[model samples]
Target: MSDDQLFALANALPLVGWLALCLAPLARPALVASARVVAAAMAVGYAVMVGLALARAGGPAPDLTTLSGLARAFSDPHVMLVGWVHYLALDLWTGAWEAEDAGRRGVPHWLLLPCLALTFLAGPIGLLLFLGVRTLPGRRVPARP
Candidate 1:
């Protein structure tokens, strides 16, 4: 497939997982299952894509050590796709964790949807938001071992 097509696939994969996760409060099992499956896919996909990016005819790999270096890295299409997928994988993972934690705490579905959205938009930011919510005074239920 073309690089652009592959990039679309990479983007779509996480959205599928994220959508399942958004329904976690109603179906914790689904979220848990998708979390595991998506995590596996992300890992394998990243490894494969990294290999491709390294082999592709393009500029050097992203220099994450500095802001300018990082920008230069994303100038390549393959590298950009890898970076996007990286975000998608981590964001989904974060959202899955939030769903599990929220489930344990008995947080309402109403609240979790937005948190999931935020997580999808910005991985750590959403996690921080949920952490704040998780810490607020409320009835906390013990999680199943």
Candidate 2:
């Protein structure tokens, strides 16, 4: 498939997981499992794209060390797609964890919905919101094994 088509697929893959997270609190296990599957699929795509980027002829190897080097590396659409998929996979994975963790901790599902939405849109910010919610008095529950 073309990179643009792959990009569209990658973007769409996590929406179901996110929607389930927000709307299906009772099906936490299934939701989490589905999120894992989606993230894994995205991760496989990411790995293949990375390998392709590395193997492509006549381009400087992707540089993650310096800001300018990183910018230059991401100038390639393939590398950008890899980065986008990385974010999609990890953010959706994080939202799944947040949903599971919040459910375990007895945090209200209503409270978690915003956090999940934030995580879907802006990963760390949503995590930060969830972490803050976890600190409220009486929100604590023993960590999962």
Candidate 3:
């Protein structure tokens, strides 16, 4: 496939995968079951896409398919995905922690779902949105006795 095709494919798979997860509750008997399926599918798809990108980037040989393939993949894709993934992962982790910390905050789960979706679509944007929404301004009120 051409670079354009690969780039399109790279972006489409994660977006579609997240959309699948977002809609899975309506399609399955159990939310946990749906989540597991979506997560597995996305992980595999992401791995393959990254590998292909690295190969196309001219860092490594495509034949390297295992952990041993790293030296090869590292040569081309330039590890660009790693930094994004790291940022996304940390953002999600902290978001969850902040949600837990909001004892009386009672933030809705729906509010978080979109942020999680965006993180996978574009890491930095998703993370910033998450933080911003979490810290949204509150209504002003007079002090109580």
Candidate 4:
């Protein structure tokens, strides 16, 4: 597939998990499991794209050791797509974890919706928001023995 096609696929795959998390609170376990599967699939795609990017670098490979080097590496479209897929995979995985954790902690599903939306749009910010939300009074559930 063309890199652009692959990028589109990578972007689309995570939405299934996100939709399940947002729409099906009662199916947390299944949704989380499926999200992990989606993330794993993206990771495999990332590895393949990275390998292709490296192989296609006929001249000096993009250096990854410094900030400037990393920027230069990302200048290559293939490398940039690989990086984006990496972000999509990890962000979806993190969202899955957040959903499961929030469900376990007794946080209201309504409260979690915004956090999930934030996470879908901006990964760490959504996580930070969820973390803060979990700490609110009356949200905590006692640990099970």
Provide the RMSD of all predictions against the true structure, rounded to 1 decimal: 2.2, 1.7, 9.7, 1.6
Q: How would you order the candidates by lDDT, starting with the best?
A: 4, 2, 1, 3
User: Per-residue alpha-carbon lDDT of model 4 for 35-144, expressed as tens digits?
Assistant: 88888888898888878777776898667899999998888777888999999988888888888888889889999999989998999999999999999998778788
Descending-TM-score candidate ranking: 2, 4, 1, 3
- Displacement of residue 88 (Cα, Å) in model 3 is 9.5
Candidate with the greatest TM-score versus the true structure: 2
Among residues 3 or more apart in sequence or in different chains, the pairs in candidate 2 whose N, CA or C atoms overlap within 3 Å are none
Question: Candidates' lDDT values, in order?
Answer: 0.79, 0.86, 0.49, 0.87
* TM-score of each predicted structure versus truth: 0.86, 0.91, 0.37, 0.91
Residue 68 in model 1: shift from native, Å? 2.3
For 1-145, candidate 1 gives per-residue lDDT tens digits of 8879888787778777887887676679777678758966986888888887678747654578998988887887777888877787777887888888788887877788778888888777788888888877874788568
Task: Give me the runs in candidate 2 sitting further than 4 Å from their true place.
Answer: 140-145
lDDT of 2 at 116: 88
Query: Which is superior by lDDT, 1 or 3?
Result: 1
Question: For residues 21-82, what per-residue lDDT tens digits would candidate 2 score against the true structure?
Answer: 87647788887888878888888888988888777747655577999999988887887888
Once fitted onto the true fold, the runs of candidate 1 whose alpha carbons sit more than 4 angstroms away are: 56-62, 143-145
In candidate 3 the C-alpha lDDT for residue 16 amounts to 41
User: What lDDT is reached at residue 11 by model 3?
Assistant: 48
Q: What is the lDDT of candidate 2?
A: 0.86
